[model samples]
Target: MLTSTGKLLSMGGKPRNKSLSLPFLMNISNTASKQMTKLRTLQIGNVDVIGSRFNGQELHSALCAEGFDSHHLVWRKMGSDAKTTEIDYPFKTPMNNALKKLESDLSIQSILHPAPFAIALNEHFRAADLVHYHLLHTGWFSLLGLPLLTKNKPSIMTLHDPWSMTGHCSYPRSCDRWMTGCGDCPDLEVIQLMKKDNTHGMWKAKRDVFAKANLEIVVASKWMLEKVQTSPIFSHFKHHLIPFGIDLEKFRPGDSEVARKKLGIYPGNTVICLRATVSPFKGLPYIYEALEKLSTTKPLTILTLEDKQLFKDYLGKHQLIDLGWLEDSNLIAEAYRAADIFLMPSTAEAFGVMAIEAMASGKPTIVFEGTSLPEVTFAPKGAIAVPMGDSDALTESLRRLIENKELRNSIGKEARQLAEAHYNWKTHVSRIIELYEQVMSEKATKANR
Candidate 1:
């Protein structure tokens, strides 16, 4: 585990220099007096990772706490977190809005925005020893400037979805056209929908940028890594398979009685918790269909987190509890604790953070096959997985978990164990930090050569 300079390396992949007390440091020079500088990282994405979407906020805070100078540059700043900075474009809002409309019409993603230039000019970007990109297909970043923006700097992009390799879609569902050049897309109505069939052009643009850029790819699931390997655009880059992590202490098993009481739920009901937002890729229609097939003696209570409330009119006699969008981690954890079952039947999920959170919270979660969920939850072992889009199978899976208390307990226990062993928050952050060191070390070696 020793680095190139023969510095003593620790199990966590950080160099332990006798002269320097700090564990994480960038050796800027190999002269007589090796200047040990603190590593500064700049993370760019559409929104703050600390928000509802993912668990990136944990990494950002962990980086800062570990004495690494970390800054998050998001397009929309949600909270007063000092580590996050909002991107300030030079153009007026109206002009940018117009450009967005034009870009969408022409099916050119991230080409019209000057946000990349803005990011390059930012003080944090200039001072950053490494830059990490996340969720960049949100239409604000400029793909054309990716090579120039990352020039002479070690860069990493976490493939939050399959959008980076494909033409227009994020998941591609069952489509394998991304393996080729991505011409003549079968469905343009997918997420990040295109106005025209300029998918080939957009795919080519990304390929060109990635060809010139020194970028490493990271995926949270093995399923996603397979797609990356098949991608004509991203297959050449180095890939990191790092699963997402959650705070096990906050999301650990709790008394369901207490959780239900706090959430205002009476006894004698089977509670199922799921994400509220309705998307084409989330397989909401199948969820609705499965609910219709289940015939349970106990009353059903559907608890939803996030914005949309889809169960109000759908569940006839069943109860519906929508907590709306939750920003606080405590409340979100409480919602999971109250649930007897957690369902995520996504047709195209890269890596489901909620699935692992529910697993850590000791819930028997169910997911569909043909997506990352099966691999993420360890399939039929850590979670109950049914065939993709098969409502009848989903209903049978639900019935098996509901009618049998011992089965639910066993599955939940195993799920929690899996989450702890594989998805520890500290381990996840340390692995990433190691990646940063690896990338920096390789670059330094190349420069010396």
Candidate 2:
């Protein structure tokens, strides 16, 4: 039960069947949650995952639906659909905030300075039964604040990238400096930092700082889970593996003919899909080269969510359907339905959620065989796993899908079935709640002793 001051109280002193009309967030520090017989969770993230369309937001909304007091404390808002009870990190000034963003790749600055976001957490941190922290390094929230904020609390940190493991880089591709100790940084220039490499000290600081806190870990993919096991710091803690989930209803199969008509795509036109930032890891160049080799006898269009200017150089007279950035689920589903095949030829991914989203929309996906893609794609059924970074292989996969309508439709049907069977929101959230219950139960037992 929530008191007038937004604190959690044991409901044994209160009545059952009462509607919780209190605001979603309540700061219940100093209230002692052990007295309560029921479980209440506190999920923390850098964005209102419920309002946003990211995979993390999907999990946030699912948690809210399960009756947990879930809230996303964000540093910034991208869209204007404001959610209730979000605690924004207090920035000192507009210019200072912009300059600080440049150091996002390194946690060295965070170790030196303190963020006001930690102040908010201190005031409200102890209010929940267990706290779950998600992807934080987005120009705000400091990793330096973690040990202090989560000290002695039953908290869980979900590893989204290797940034926490390494001194600087998020995805340390082909780098094993993080294994022994992060020093003699190889990706210094790529980090785009203004200063020299202090990766060794930065990594050492995280080891020492995090050692003080009682924290659990969660990884979204088997690849990431492997990293956790090998890492010197993360290997010491308990962890869980929870893959992402998508909304089946919102991303369900739509009328392909109607969708194509709506998008102004004429009959006999083959639509190919690509999504990702203009990064090397996402295989943008592979997508570019593969499309260049595609047979052009039939009218072909590249359906992309990124703006035209971003891919202006790559668009060599090829038909382009640019939707810019889409936040609405229905519009994304429309794009998926209008397309003949979805291609995410990336070498790296942490449980590719967008690939599943395309599959859930009944579109046959094509991906490179590496990282979390193979596990997530359900290849030969939902998607075809091609050799990573081979444009010829990608072209062959795309050609096979475009040439045979029956094969494409068959793959799409299996893709939807795969999504329905394994990637539904309910099953994913239930597993999360199970973890929550186990953590809280241990806490209760500890308190009794």
Candidate 3:
């Protein structure tokens, strides 16, 4: 229950629900939520392109559906969303672009990017009753302007990755330097790489910015929330764990026979679908090793999205059907529907939206442990998880699903049930709306006091 001051109260004065369950989010009263319909919301993030950007776009549309005067501001415009406005990055000349590249190469990323300050001057930001930010560190918004952007607003930031807390790199692979001041980085070649080791200085700069910033943090998984709790830069802020949701209706279980016919795949072949990415964090080496170990009498058809030719060498013995960067969500959902099993063995994921999408499509998914995939997918029940980089275990799990039809059916059914109960798009929007209202109410109480 929510108190008059908008603070969440426990049932009968007990502790409140803290888990990423739907029931906790449902605690917000309908009257409070209805009041938020007239609220103006401004969401800022990297433009809607692929990955996490799509999540922001979905939320923007959902808020509009809920009658909020919602607007989106992005660093660039990759999609044709009418409500979204692109930030004005000055000096788009050739020399300026070269200088920007040089700055990024030196690891001074987003410092020269004017998107953060530009957002403060944006009309949408000025009129917004509540402000939400996502994916700000993707070579766009600088942390230096975060304090100014959020100073007098009821602001919330959805931490899509560990990038906000860390000095450099989105994922601190095997490096504990981020916990400390982050000096002397072991690997400068990590994503958002810094050619020079100014990690300590960068870390200190972020810490200073965070000290002056008034923002509530949201994480999609317990693993990510744990990361936030441990970070000296962000440990003081209020935190919420809300799992990412998917379109249950669009990605629901479908007939494999019909889907295969639509995709032109052999109806009798056992199909395994996966998003093919070249990133080392995705654990593609383990996937290749696991596929090599699988000894099947019949050739297994490999279905891939994004890059197609990455698996061209394995095409002779095993069939490869590459969907090649699908822009249409319906087609992507169909790719999931056509497959009997889905593989997303990411080694260092914050959260796996694809795993849940596969689960919603009623396909048994295989993932590796030590990341948020297991928890997000409800491991050993909705999805199968093996030790990280254990190709043997991955191969064994794949073989079990391929050989046993009953096991696949059982797991797929369970995955679908969990996806329906927990990952509904409407439920996700409702949770976010409740948070917006709570933040506004708290701000009001503070002003009254």
Candidate 4:
């Protein structure tokens, strides 16, 4: 529970003090410290974490509210609706055009789309005290930008997904090729969609980039930390584990019956909510497979955040309610509250923010054993985690929960407790502040030298 700052206070609590310690000195340290120190700001660059319903929004907003002078450097401003200033790079180079054509021709992930306007962005680079880089595969940032970002300021890159460490795919599902050097990709055509394999070249390019840039890594989950540590590219950097946090007040428990009524679910119906976006790795099919096995006495209404047509082929028998990609967090929270159980059968999830949102709403969530879901939700206590791709286990778990109301209530209580204990936005932002302090200290130390 105690941090380094806490240890400082703990040491201060005792009688042993420095010879220079004085009440007057302490007041000056607290009061006039801000004026004494030059204005400090962290320049945050990302593809699209700022102005969107993305997982990083809460942390970004919280930092801004805490008087942190933060600016978001984005590409195209994908979601300009969320609260944040998105400064986009408008210039393009011939190399950028060539890379764009190459990306289309090779069916590669954004390899080197946006060429950095070094001359144009010189002022930004010089003024920034620190750089916090989020997702960079969005055609806005390139492997080349790493050198520029790390040249002057301390750069912290948050590992939101495995893309930073991998060759091509964002979530390399069971593919260890990324570790050794991604070649002969298991799903070559499926993932890369190329006649000729370029995974080796891709992996080598990223490895070279990491070698060129000095970056501090922050993993959002323990699972992510383990996976990223295996990469030779990132092995040499400083790594920290910091889970994504949620707004507790907005996502708290509400009346299930009221929520169910609002969502138009009839009484005696067991509701299951699936909020997976349209990604193959998200594993939406597992939910459908599980549903095919369940023959419940209670009417089963499956609430899907995605398009209903995605499940139309399989969910033929059951009642399906599609909210169709919610932008409002309140509505999403209501849907979570309305559901008796939340289903996240993802084969590969980095942090599972949807699962966190569901748990924060006091719902008993179900996820696969592998990947970050189990660790993020605190399995067996906060949520039920089954073996990966085991729809039968998921079906049985759902059946047991539906049959036993007491078990559901107890788990829901534990889930809410887990949300408070770990996933609160306040806790996440405080840790970020700690990291920022560490970065500033290093910067000051280097400057003094």
Highest lDDT model number: 3
89: Cα error in model 3, Å: 4.9
Root-mean-square deviation per candidate: 5.1, 8.4, 3.6, 5.4
lDDT (tens digit, per residue) of candidate 1 on 62-167: 7777677888888888778898898896564666788889998788887878888888888998989999888777767788888998787889888888888888
Per-residue CA lDDT of candidate 2, range 26-47, in tens? 2111122232324445556656
Question: Residue 22 deviation, candidate 4, in Å?
Answer: 25
Per-model CA lDDT versus the true structure: 0.80, 0.68, 0.81, 0.70
TM-score of each: 0.90, 0.83, 0.92, 0.85
1 or 2, which is superior by lDDT? 1
Q: Which regions of candidate 2 deviate over 4 angstroms?
A: 1-39, 49-58, 77-83, 86-91, 94-109, 120-123, 191-195, 311-317
Q: In candidate 3, which residue pairs get closer than 3 Å at backbone N, Cα or C atoms, i.e. clash?
A: none
Prediction 3 global C-alpha lDDT:
0.81
Can you write out model 4's per-residue Cα lDDT over 75-128, one digit (the tens) per residue? 444666344445544554455567767875775655565545542275544676
Could you say which candidate leads in TM-score? 3
Candidate 4: how large is its RMSD? Answer: 5.4
Q: Candidate order by TM-score, highest to lowest?
A: 3, 1, 4, 2
